[model samples]
Target: MTESQFFTPHDLPARWRRKRAFTFVDTTFSAFLALWQRWHDDENRCDRLHVVALAHLPALDTPPPADDPSPLAAELARAWPMRVPGTQRLEFDAGRVVLTLAIGDDIETLLSRLWLRADAFHLDLTATADPRKLCKTLARFAGDDATVCAFTADKQQLERALQASGFACTPRDAYTDAPVTARFAPRWRVRRHEPPLPCEANAREAIVIGAGLAGCAVSSRLAGRGWRVTLIDRHALPARDASGNPAGVFHPIVWRDDSVAARLTRAGFLYALRRWHALESAHHDLQRTGAGLLQIADTSDDAKALAHAIARFAYPPAYVQPMTRDEASRMAGVDVERGGWFFPLGGAISPAAVCAAQLADASANITPRMNTDVTRIAHDGRVWRAFDASGAEIASAPVLVLASAHDAARLAGLHGEPTRSVRGQLSVLDPCALDALRLPVIGEGYAVPLGQDGVLIGATYDIDDADGEIRADGHRENIERVAGMLPALANTSPGIRAGRVAFRCVTSDRMPMIGQFADENAARLNARELSGAWPLDLPRMPGLYGAFAFGSRGLVWATLAAELIASQIEGEPWPVERELAESVDPARFLLRLLRHGEFCAA
Candidate 1:
C-alpha cells in the first residue's frame, strides 16, 4: 500500500497547528513566532518544537523606540538582553518550545554545524543570499519530504530556484507571507553533507573515573538519563581533591568587550543556577551564605573600568553591579580599602555538600566504588575495563568518561598536549578575627565566612607546584592578599600551619576540555581527507569522553560541562552554541595542528 503524505507551507495555525514535535528553519523569526504563539497547545500536554532561525536579529543589535506600536517592536524593547554574534537558545512555555537563533553573517557555515534535522523550512531570501544558493543550503537539513515556504519580493526568481533544487513547486495564494509552496523530492541526485550521527553504545552501563565535582556531576546527569553509572575513584569519597575547599565562590567574569571568557562564563553562571535549583527541588541539601559575594578590585582604576562595563552591557542588577568604597564596606560588614564590583547572585557554597547531594539524588542509578584506584585502562573492542595497581579489573563498561583533573589526559594517553597541575592551598581563619565580616570578599585572594566553621581564606595559586603538603609561606601569602583588600585583616595571622593543599588541573588555553576524545592516530592517517576540518570532523574514540582542565572555575563550569556531555551522549539538543562548543573541544589542539600542516612533514 503506497500512501502519499500531503504537506504545505501555510501560516503556523493552518500548516503545523497539530504538530506534536517539529523541526523548523527560518531566516526572519517574526512569522513563525507569531504562528507558535497562537498554535502552541500547552494546556493538554508538554509540546515539543525545535526551531532554527537565521537572522541578524535586529532587536538585539538596537532597540526600537519605546513608543513603537507593534507587538514585535514592544518585544524588541522589553525582552532584549545580550546578543553577540553567535547561536542563542531561548526557552518558552516551560521549555516545550526552543528557538535556536543563529545570528551571524554566513547561513551556510552556521547551518552546516547544527546537529539537528529540519522537518519544515521558511526563508526570506535577499540578493546577498540569492534564492538558488539558499535553497541548496536548506535542502541539506530538510527531511526527505520536507515542505518549504519562502518570502521574497522577486516571486519568479524564488520559485525558479526552488524548482531547480529538487522541490515540486506550486504558487499558493497568500498562504503565508511567501506566495510559493515547495515540496522536496529532487529529479537528480546530489551528495549533501549530513550532520554527525549519534554514537551507539553496546550497553547502557558506563564507568566514570573520578569522584571529584566533575565526576559526580557527570554521573548524576548520565544517571538521570537512564544510564547505569559506575563511579570509581582513587579516594574514599567525592570532593576530597581540589573540590574539598571549605567554601568556594561562583560568578561570571566581566570584560570590557565581553570577551569569550566573559560570554562563556555568563552562560555557565546562568545555567548552573537553574541546574542547582533543580537539584534542590529534588531534595539535595546545599549549604551557602544566601547570595551576594563581593569582589574587590586588583587596583582602583580597574574597578572603575569594570563598573563601566556592567552599565554598558546593561547587566541585570540581580547579577552584578559597581559599588563605592562605603557601599562595599557596608556589604562586607568590614572596612574595605578599595571600591569594587559586587555579585548579587554570587556567594560561598560548601563544595563537599554539593558533591554528596548529587550522588544521593542519583543513588538509585549510581554505584559508587570508593578507594578503587584506576591505574590502567583498556578497551576490549566493545567494553572498556579499568585495572588497579595489581592489574586486577575493578570496573568495566561500554562507555568511559575521565574527569580526574590532571590525571585525565594521562589516563586517556593524551600527555603531550600540554595539560599540567598547579598546587593551591586555602586557609581557615578564626571566627573572632573575621567577626566583623558579613559576606565573602575576594580580591587577590578570597575570604569566605562559614559562620560556625570559622572563616576560609588564602588559596595561593602557585604554578608547577606538585607538593601537596601545606607550607607556612603559602599561608602568609594568603593572609597578605586578603589583608590588602580589607585593611583590618592586617592584624590577623591564622594560616601559619593550618590549611588544605590540593593540585588544580590547568590547560594551556584555560578553557576546560569537554567532549569526545579525538583519535590522534586516525586524524594523522586521514590528514589529506581532513585538510580543513572542524571539531566534529575529527575522528573520535567511540564511547570515550573527558571533562577536565576546569582549573578554579569548577564551581561554575562543572554542571554545564556535565550537561553538555550528557547532551552529546543522549543525542539531545546542545545547551551551548557551536563556536563555544568548539572552543572547549578536546581535539581542538589536534585540529589546530592539522590546520597548520604541522604533521604533514612527518
Candidate 2:
C-alpha cells in the first residue's frame, strides 16, 4: 500500500496529538522514510517521535536527486549509514525525532530480538514468512491502545491473524484493496511481562556522583530532559581522575567477525561523534583533532586478514579503509610499522575539554558540589542520600547515579568487588621531540600530536597497582612501546621527565557497568526462587543507576552510557538494543552469582 493510503494527513496529526512521545515500528525502509518525512513536516507534532525500521538490506548508498524538492529526503541521504549488520541510530529535528535502523538479513530474527513498547505498527505483510507468527511477535511489543495498519493482499488471513494475536480488527470498507486496521484489545493476556512504563518520580531531581566523563555526561543528558541534577565530586573540578588525561583516542573496533564488543563500540563511536559535533556547533572547544588516525597491526598477516574481512563486509571508505605500510606512513607523516586500517573520523581529544563542554552545556540545570567526599550512600525507600566523612548529608534525591569509576561497585555494595583499578602513567614529550609526527597513530601504544602542548604518549596499564607517583620505568616502557610503532622515537633521548599517573576502573570482562542496580537484599531473600532468573527478572533498586567501569574506552563509551541511563530513568526507549544493554547491566555479576547458587541467606 502507498504511504498516504496507510496514514492520511487528516489521521496522522490526530494520532500524534494524543501522546507526548510516540513510537512507530515499520518493517520496510520506504514506509519508514515516508513516515519520518511526514513527522518532520508536522509542526504541531509530539515532543518525541521514535521510528524503528527493520530492513533486510543496508542503507541506501546513492544520494538523493539534487533536483528533488523534499528537503527531508536530502537530509536523510546525507546521514545514510554504513553497510553494517547492526542497529544504527540517526537523529533529526535536534534529536527530537529518532530513527533506529535495524539492518540484517533475517527480518523475523531481527523482530524477535527487539525490545520496545511500540505504540503503532506499519507492517508490510508481503515481507514476512508467516503473517500469524509475525502478528504474535508484534503483540509482544504492543502497548495499551496500540494500533496497527498492515498491507496485505489476503485480507481474510490477515484479519484472522490479527484477531488471534489479540488485535480487534475493524470492519472492512467498500474498497477490497484497502489496508487492514486493528486495535490491540485482547480478551486474555498476550504477553508474559508487562510493557515498560514511565518511571514514577516525585520530582525531576537527581544526584549524580563523580564529575568526570560518565558523571558529567549523565548530568548533561538529564538536565537536557528538564531534570535538575546535583553533581558531586571529591575533586575540586571535573575530569580530574581517569578523565583528566591530556588526550585520548576514540575509534570503533573491527574484528574478523562482528562481535559484541565491536558492535557496542561502533554504536558508541557513532553516538560520540554526533554529540561532539553538537558541542562544537555550540562553540565548545573540545581540543579534538580533525585529521584521521592510523592503526598499526602487529603482523602483516593480521592486516591482510582484516583487509579481506573489511572487503567482505563492504565497509564504507568514509568509516574505515585498509592502508598499506606506505599509505599509513603518509597518513601519520611518520610511521614505521606493518599495514593496517585507518579510521577517517577517529582521532584524539582532550578528555578534560569534553567533560567541561558537557557540563557547560547543561550549566543552567546542574549544581556542582566540588571537594566533597561521599563516604557512603543510603536510600530511605523514596530518596537516596549521600553522606560525607563526618556523616553530614551532602545531597539527596529520588534518583541517584553512581559514576565514580572503581568506587561505583563498592558504593553500590555489590558482592565480589566486580571492578578493579588499573594505574596508567602517561608521558608528555617536548614540542620538537617528534617533528616528523603529524596525526595520531595507535596500535600497541598511541602517539598524539597536541600542537603547542607537545606530543602526548605512553599509558602503562598496571593492573591493581595504586602507586600514584610517576616512575622513570613507566616513561621508559612508554617510549619503548611507542618507538616500536614510530621508529624515529627510538633514537630520542630518555629526557622525558614530564608525566602523570592516574588510576582507571575496569571489569574482568572489560564491559562497563551501565544501568539500574538490582535489589540484592530482595534477591537474597528469595534466592531459591531467583536462581535461574534473567537479568530483567531480578528486582531493581528504585531510582538507583550506575555508569562506570569503562576502563580505557571512556572517551568512546561515556556519552552512550549516559544516554542509556537517562533513558532508563525516564522509562524511554533504550538507545541500544536490549541484548546490548543487558551485556552492560550493573547486575550482570549478581545475576551470574545467583545462577551459580553462590548466595546465602542473610
Clashing pairs in 1: none
Candidate 2: tens digits of C-alpha lDDT, residues 126-207? 6554688888888988988788888777778888989998999989784677778898999998877765666678999999
Model 2 TM-score? Answer: 0.95
The reply for model 1, stretches above 4 Å from the true place, is 1-115, 120-193, 415-417, 494-498, 528-532, 600-602
lDDT score, residue 56, model 2? 68
How far off is residue 489 in model 2, in Å? 2.0
What is the model-wide C-alpha lDDT for candidate 1?
A: 0.75
lDDT of 1 by residue, 27-110 (tens): 665544454444353344224566677765354566556665756456435434345445555544444566666665676566
Candidate 1 least-lDDT 10 residues: 1-10
Per-residue lDDT of 204 in model 1 = 82
The top-ranked prediction according to lDDT is 2
Output the worst ten-in-a-row residue range by lDDT, candidate 2: 56-65
Candidate 2 residue runs with Cα over 4 Å from true position: 1-3, 6-11, 31-44, 63-65, 173-175, 431-433
